[model samples]
Target: MEMLYAKWLFNGKEILKGLGCVSHNNMVVDLLPIKLAKKTYPEAVVKDYGEGVLFSGFVNAHTHLDLSNVSIEPYLGFVKWLKTMIETKVQANETQTDEAIKKALDSLIKSGVCAVADISNTLKSCNYLKKIPKAIVFFENYSLRKKQAQEKIAYIENNIENIRQTYKMKIDVTAHSVYSTHRDLLGYTMLKNNPKFGSDLFSFHFLESEFENPFVNSRGDLFEMLQEKGLIDNQLHFSSAIEYIKSLGDIKKGLFVHCVHIKPDEIEYLKSIDASIVIAPRSNYYISKSLPNLELLKNSGINVAIGTDSLASNWDLNIINELKFLYKHYSHIDPAYFFGIATTGGYTALNLHIGFKKGFYAYPFFMETTTNNALEEILQ
Candidate 1:
C-alpha cells in the first residue's frame, strides 16, 4: 500500500486540492484529503510530490504508428504531403517500419501515454500494441472502386481475425475518409448488419482539408488526382463531405478525427449524432496551415478530444505537448478542459474506462509546477 499526495489532483472529471490517492497492487483504492489519507492509512508509506500536479495517464486518441518514419516538414498542402507520404512508404522497407514503430512506442510510453487509438493500413503494429493492453487498433480501409470494395473488405476482415487471434488486442475497421473511400465501401462497413461489420467503436478522418470539400463536390485538385488514378467515377456527386458520410447511415458514438473544416450546421449535425470530435490542432496547422474552429465546437456543446495524429504530421507524440500547443494558441479555453479531453475524452473514444477512479489502474502522471494552477503552468 502507498499514498501519493500532490498539490493538485485531477480525478478524471475535475481538479481538487489537498487530496491524495491510495494505491494497492497497482490500482487506485481511494482518493481523499491528505489528512484523511494519513489517518486512514497510518501504516502505509506516504510520498508527497510537492508543487506538482497529478492526473490520469494520457490517451492518444489517434495516431499512425506505421507512418511514424515519414518526414515532419510542413507541406505546402495536404495533398502534396499525402503524396509524399505514399512515395516515402514505397521506399521504406520492413526493417525501417518496425524500427520506427519501436521508436514511436518508446516515445509515447516515456511521454506518459497509457492508451492509444492507433490507425493502421497494414496493422503492422499489432504485435507492439498487444503489449499495451489499452490500445485500440483501427484497421484503415480505402477503396474508391466499388468493384474492389469487397476484396478490400475481405482483406480487412482477415487481418482483423488474425490480429484478434494472435494478439488479443481490440480491433475495429474504419473508412479512410469520404473522398478516399467509396460510398459502397463505407456503407458495407458502417451499415451492414453482420457482426463482422459492426463494432461499438469506429473512427475516420473527416473534413481534414478544404480540398476534401471540392473533392466531394467532384471539382478540385483532389478530384483530378482521383481521376488521374481512376479512383472516382464521373457519376460521383456530394454536396459536402459530412453530408456524404451521414448519407451512409448512423455513425454516432465514434471518434471523428480532424474536423478542422466543418461548418456550423455540420457541427450541429455531429452533435445530434453524439459523436466525439478529435482535434489535432498542431497537425492541422502543420499540413493545412489551418486549425479547427474550436469556439464553434465549444459553443455547440460537443465532446472534444485531442490527438498527436502521428510523427508524420507532428513533431512528437506527446499529449502534454499537444495540450501546451492548445493552451498557447487558444488561451481563452481553460486548461482543465483540455486536461479532461486528453484524459477522459481519449479513454472514452477508445472504449476504455478512465483509470482515475477506484478499482481501476492508477496510472497517474506527474507534472512539475510551482504555480497554483498546475495545469496552466504545465502547459507553459
Candidate 2:
C-alpha cells in the first residue's frame, strides 16, 4: 500500500484541501486526510508531495491518435488542409504510422493523460490506446451505399468480440459526421452501439466550420467542394446536423466534438439527451478561425469536456496545453473549473466507471505548484 498526499486533491467532483489518497497496486482504495490515511493503512508507504496538487490524471474526451502521423498546419486553408491530411494518411507507410502512434501516445501520457476517448478512422491507434489507463476507441465508419456499409458492419459483427477480448479494450462503431456518412450507414452503425459502453457513447465531428451546416443543409462551400470532387450527390439534406442525426436515429448521449456552429436549442437538445460537448478550442480556431461560444456553453449548464484534437490541426496532444488555452480564452471563469473539465468532467462525460473498480482519475499524480491556485498553477 502507498499513501499520496498533496496540498489539494480532486476526488472526481471538486477540489478540496487537506486530503490524500491511498492505493494498492495502482488502484486507488481510499481518499482521506493524512492522519486517517496513515491510521487506516498503517503498513503503507507515504509520499509527501509538498505544496502541490494530487489528483487522477486528465481524461481527454476526444482526440484522433491515428492522426499523430499526420500534421496539416492549421489555417493555411481548411479544404487544402483536409486534402493534405487525406493524402498524407494514404501515402504513409506502416512502420512510420506505428512509430508515430507510439510517439504521440508517449507525449500524451507524459503530459498526464490517463484516459482518452479517441476518434479513429483507420483504427490503427486502437492497438496502442490500450497503453492508457482508460481508452475508448470510436472507429468511424463512412459509406454512402448500403451494401458497403453492410460489409463494414459485417466485419465488426464478426470481429468485434474477438477484438475486444484480444485487445482488452472498449471500441464502438460510429458515423464520421452528418455530412460524410449516409443515413443508412449512420443508422446501422448507431444501432449497433454497445450498451455496456453507453448506447449513445459516440463522437461525431459536427459543425466545426461555417461551411458544415450549410453543406449538411445542402448549399454551402463544402457542398460545392464535395460536388466538385464527385464525392457527394443530392441524396439527403437537413436543416441542421442535429436534425440530420435525429432523422437517422435517436439522439446519442456521448461527447459531440467541435460544435462551433451549434445553436441555443441545439445546445438544449444536447442537454435533453444528457450529452456532453468536447471542445478543442485551439483546433476549432485553426479550422474555423473562431472558438465555440464558451460563455454560452458554460451558462447552458451542459457538461463541457476538453480535448486537443489530433496533431493534424492542433500543435500538441497535451491536455495541459488545452487547459491553458481555455484559461486564456475564458479568464472570467474559474481556472479550477477548467481543471475539472480535463479531469472529472471528462470522465463523467464518457461515463467511465469511477473509484476502486476502474477509472483513470483513480490513478492520481502530484505536480508542484508555483501560483496561488495549485490546480491552475500546475497548468502554468
Candidate 3:
C-alpha cells in the first residue's frame, strides 16, 4: 500500500487542499485528509509530492487519429484545409497511415490521456485502439447526395457488421457532420442505432464552422459542391442545424462534436436531451479562426468536454495542451473548471466512469510547479 499526498488534489469533482489518495494494485482505495491518511496507512509508504496538483488522467472526448499525418500548418481556410486533409490521406500509403496512428497513440499515452473517443474514417485504427485501456471508436460516415443516403447507410451497416464479426469490438457508427451527411442518412443511422434496432450511441458534428449555415441553407461553397452533383434544390430554406437535427428524432443520448456556433436556445435543448457538447477550441480557431462562446456554454449549465480534435487541425494530440490553450485565451474561467471539463466532463461524455474511487483504476497525473495555479503550471 502507498499514500500519495499533494498540495492540491482533484477527486474528479472538485479540487481540495491538504488531501491525498491511497492506492494499491493500480486501484485507488480512498481519498482522505493527509493526516488521516498517515494514520490509517501507518505502515504504508508515503510519497509527499510538494507544490503541484494531482488529478485523474485526461479523457480526450474527440479526436481523429487517422488524420494524424496531415500537416498542422498551411491552413488557408476551413474548406481548403479539409480538402488538403482529404487529398493528403488519399496520397498516403497504408504504411504511412499506420505509422502516423502509432505515433499519435504514443503521444497521447505520454501526455497522460487515459481514455479516448476517437473518430475514424477507416477501420485501420481499430487494431491499435483495441490495445488501449479505454477507447470508443466511432466509424465516421459522410454522404452529401440524397440519393446515396440509403447506399451509404447500407455500406456503413455492412462495415460495422464486419468489424464486429472480425474484431469482436464495440464500435459506434456516427455521422460526419450536418453538412457532409444527408438528412436522410442521419435519420436512417439514428433509427438503425436506436434501442429497438441496436442501441448504439450516435455522434454527429454540429456547427463547427460558419460556412455550415450557408451550406445547410443551400448557398455556400459546400452547397455548390453538392449542387455540382445535383443534390440540393436552390429554392430550399432550412433552419439552424440543431433544429433540422431535432426534426428527425431524439438526439438526447448522442454526442455532439465541435458546437462552435451553437446558439442559446440550442444549448437549452441540448441540455434537456442530456446530450454532451465537445469543444475543440484549438481546432476551431485553427480551421475557422473562431471559437465557441465559452462564457455562454458555462452559463448554460450544460455538460461540456474538451477535445484536441486531430493533428490535421491541431498542433498535437495532447489534451493538456488543449486545456492550456483554453486557459490562456479564456482567462476568466477558473482553471479548476476546465480541469473538470478535461477529466470528469470527458468521461461523462463517453459514458465511462474513471473517477478516483475504490475499485476504479487510479490513472493519476501529476505536475510540478511553484504556482498554485494548476492550469497555468500544467501548461508551462
The number of clashing residue pairs in each candidate reads 0, 0, 0
Higher-lDDT candidate among 1 and 3?
1
Q: RMSD for each model, in Å, please?
A: 2.0, 2.5, 2.6
Model 3 agreement with the true structure over 155-226: per-residue lDDT tens digits: 765566677678666678887887777777787666533543345666778888777777767778766765
Q: TM-score of predicted model 3?
A: 0.90
* Cα lDDT, all candidates: 0.80, 0.76, 0.78
Q: Write the per-residue lDDT of candidate 1 for residues 166-262, one digit (tens) a residue.
A: 7677778788887778887787666645477555567889989888877877888877766776777544578888778777776646778989888
User: Clash pairs of candidate 1?
Assistant: none
Write the residue-wise lDDT of candidate 2 on 167-280 in tens digits.
Answer: 677887677876677776677665434453336467877778777767767787767767676767445667777777776556557678888878889999889878888889
Query: Which structure is stronger by TM-score: 1 or 3?
Result: 1
Q: What number of backbone clashes does candidate 3 have, counting pairs of residues 3 or more apart or in separate chains?
A: 0
The full ranking of all candidates by lDDT, starting with the best, is 1, 3, 2
Q: After superposition, how far is residue 348 of candidate 3 from its true place, in Å?
A: 1.0
